[model samples]
Target: MTATPAIEGWFTTGDQPALIGERCTTCATSYFPPTAAAAGFCRNPRCEGTEFEQVELSRRGTVWSYTDTRYQPPPPYSAPEPFAPFGLAAVELPEGIVVLGQVAAGYGPDDLRVGMHVELVVEPEHTGEALIWRWKPLAEGSAA
Candidate 1:
């Protein structure tokens, strides 16, 4: 099946994957799911600069936290029949940002540990089959 991003411009898929974000030219603050940096000033209260640059976020990070979803979500989100629990993780990247995403296949909360290394991967979205970012645990002895 052909795959497309549920939300365009959020990320790109290939041999390497990275999230797209916007960085403020003045304060170095960044925003994910890239916004209209040209339309407004930086998010920092102390900086009033209006220019921003698009940047690719780090692909590797450490698992900051994780959890399991035993229940399905509300509308706009359609779970498969006889839904099974899945895992979620909050990863802290070298960029000083923490991002939340679903765990990759075969992974659950039990498979995660705080400070464990992880890397970004693209997988099909549960509800729409669109490409989305997921966190996969890095194999021991492997470098991200």
Candidate 2:
């Protein structure tokens, strides 16, 4: 079975995966999930820019916080039977925005700490039916 993104238009699946976001043309602020305002404008209150440019957010970031999900999430999320705990992290990127995602396979909340560097990775989800983005902790002394 071919792997496909769990959610489209969020992140790229490639040799180097990155989150897709939008940069306001006027204030130079960026937004994840590429915010689409009904009025079609920048989200910044100080900037009235109506145009935006697509940007790929930093591939690597430092963990701002983390947690272990011990309970199966409610639907539309399809957790596996006999749900297992998984690590999740909020990573702060160079863009000054925080992105949340699951921790990469083989690593758990025990492996995470605030300020730990991590990289974005696209991998098969718990159900193995779709692809999703996860945070892979950087090995010690690995160049950022």
lDDT of 2 by residue, 67-116 (tens): 99989899988887888999999999989889999999999999999998
| Model 2 regions more than 4 Å off | 37-39
RMSD each, Å: 1.8, 1.4
Q: For residue 54, what is the lDDT in candidate 1?
A: 90
Clashes of each: 0, 0
Q: Which residue pairs of candidate 1 clash?
A: none
Predicted structure 1, TM vs. truth: 0.91
Please report, as a residue range, the 10-residue window in candidate 2 with the lowest summed lDDT: 30-39
